[model samples]
Target: MDTIAVDPDLYAAQSAYAPDDWQSETTSIRSSIYRGLMDNGRRIPSDEQQFETYEAGHLVDLILDSDRDNPLFRSPIGADRERPLQVLDIGTGKGTWAIDVADMFPNATVRGVDLFPPPVTWMPPNCVIEVDDVLQDWTWRERFDLIHMRNMIGSFDNAEWDRVYEQCFEKMAPGGWIEQLEVGPFITSDDNSLPEDSALASWGPILQKCGDRAGRPCDIVLTMPQSIKNAGFVDVHEKVYKWPIGPWPRDQKFKEAGMVNSQHWMSGMEGWCMWLLTKYGDPEPWTKDEVHVFCAKLRNELKNPHYHAYHKA
Candidate 1:
């Protein structure tokens, strides 16, 4: 469902892969939720329906950080607003975050790069949402003041991840900052509202194993701290949040965040799981129908009000 725009001249001159020769075998007609790019090995959806899901995720992020002065990002880059800053957003799905940041820092140049261009019609003069694969050599002339990535958990393997972080370090200005946010795949309840024996409870380990089997590890949320440090970044700051799954939280902000996040999961889960489960399910590869049936059960569990399910971020 995702559409990528590759520059033909750039591809021909800089790489061996052609645009048309660039299809992934992971696409399944039976699973309407997903298509893959062999380049990033990513199956994040991009249709109108799925774009709504990504928009919901962007809203959830805003609601969670609403109390902060600048919820767009935590990097301390734009303290002197008049001073021109360069910012790069890797994996900029939907481009809402990049657009907001551009507005926030009108003098700054904000570049939102992704394998697929965001489904946005218009952007601010300071914002540029371009299609790019970051694994290749970065061609930008100016170094970035801030480099940010979010929801990029399963996009790369270990070596590729090191390369990405290294690129982040190399492309950044001398005192630049890098921030990444990822959510845990596990759904958990503190008061045992959801039983451990339930199929929904097994969601974490199931996909974790599937990701491992597929060679793109999905445990980036847990391992990112050390990995970032290993990439030569210092003065690392970490923040964690317990993101409630449904509108079950008593606090007003969390309840609102949960409501948005519920839709996020409802819309994005099928696409997220299709490639991993169908290609690397336990016992054997599962059929696309089986993946859809399992996602339906998960959705039902998410809709249960009594179950206070949440995943760590």
Candidate 2:
């Protein structure tokens, strides 16, 4: 990708807070030792990064109707109030899903594990957060009634998947359910309106190349259902949801979700591109300026309603 000079005023009007407040709030959250960083060596947990997490979570919930309704796919661990339940949310960014699940099932204890600490000032008594890497050895055996993993697409290597699934199987109770949610790296369009040369079209291959060089290919979504079954989880079910990147869908529900998803992608482009491209792209790593130029192009593509593109999960 070519490194074009980005106009400083491109995002000037989008700032919602003063620069000082943004810097201070971001600095306050920088004390966590486990926090990940971009190739530029900047910590990941900034005000903008946290907002992307919240926005993406909200968009997915809207698309899946995960809030205010039970999952259409039922778990073997039925709703028996007499039996105490234990829930595990792996790679829970910001602990949003865990907190919601805890609220939904008051009797169930929800535990969220991730490298970074959760940001909430208050959490339900039944909900707790643990800072740990999921790829490491899991000490808890047969301890959970349900295991939930979401948006963990680019976090693990190809060789690590089997072991991770095996660990999940070992940690779940006899009749527990394991649900894995992920968006495929590829972008598609029903009407073929998405230009082949568009920045959005180029995103997947670039990221995939980065992942391959980093030893963690991000194509696991294509094979996770089989992997789960191989791990000895019975009755594995996969439900694919298409999330429009722009507000071009006819259905009101999808249109709403598409709007939010568009915003989510817009806000997340910088953070996503910077680290992956800088650290793993072969031949030559992408500089911050090149990432900025690429992201500017991506933002423009995301807003083009004529593209009619959507990503599947």
Residue 185 in model 2: shift from native, Å?
Answer: 1.3
- Per-model C-alpha RMSD: 14.1, 9.5
**Residue-pair clashes, model 1:** 0
lDDT of 1 by residue, 1-313 (tens): 1111222243233221111111221121122112111122232444566676666677677777877888778877788989999999998988877877897899899999999967676688999998999899888888999998988888999999999999999898989999988988898887787889766788898999999998888878999999999999999998887787765666656665666677778778888889998899997999999998998888777766656778888
CA lDDT of every candidate: 0.76, 0.68
lDDT tens readout by residue for model 2, 1-313: 1111222332442321222232342332221211221222332344647555553544444444633246422465636866888899888887767876787688889999989886666688999999998888986643888888877877787668888889888887867888877878787787687988888998888888887888777777888988888888877777677777655665545554565566667666687668888887657998888888998888777766567777777
Deviation (Å) of 96 in candidate 2: 0.4
TM-scores of all models? 0.84, 0.80
Candidate 1: segments with Cα more than 4 A from true spot: 1-47
- Residue 57 of model 2 has an lDDT of 44
TM-score of 1: 0.84
lDDT score, candidate 1, position 233: 97
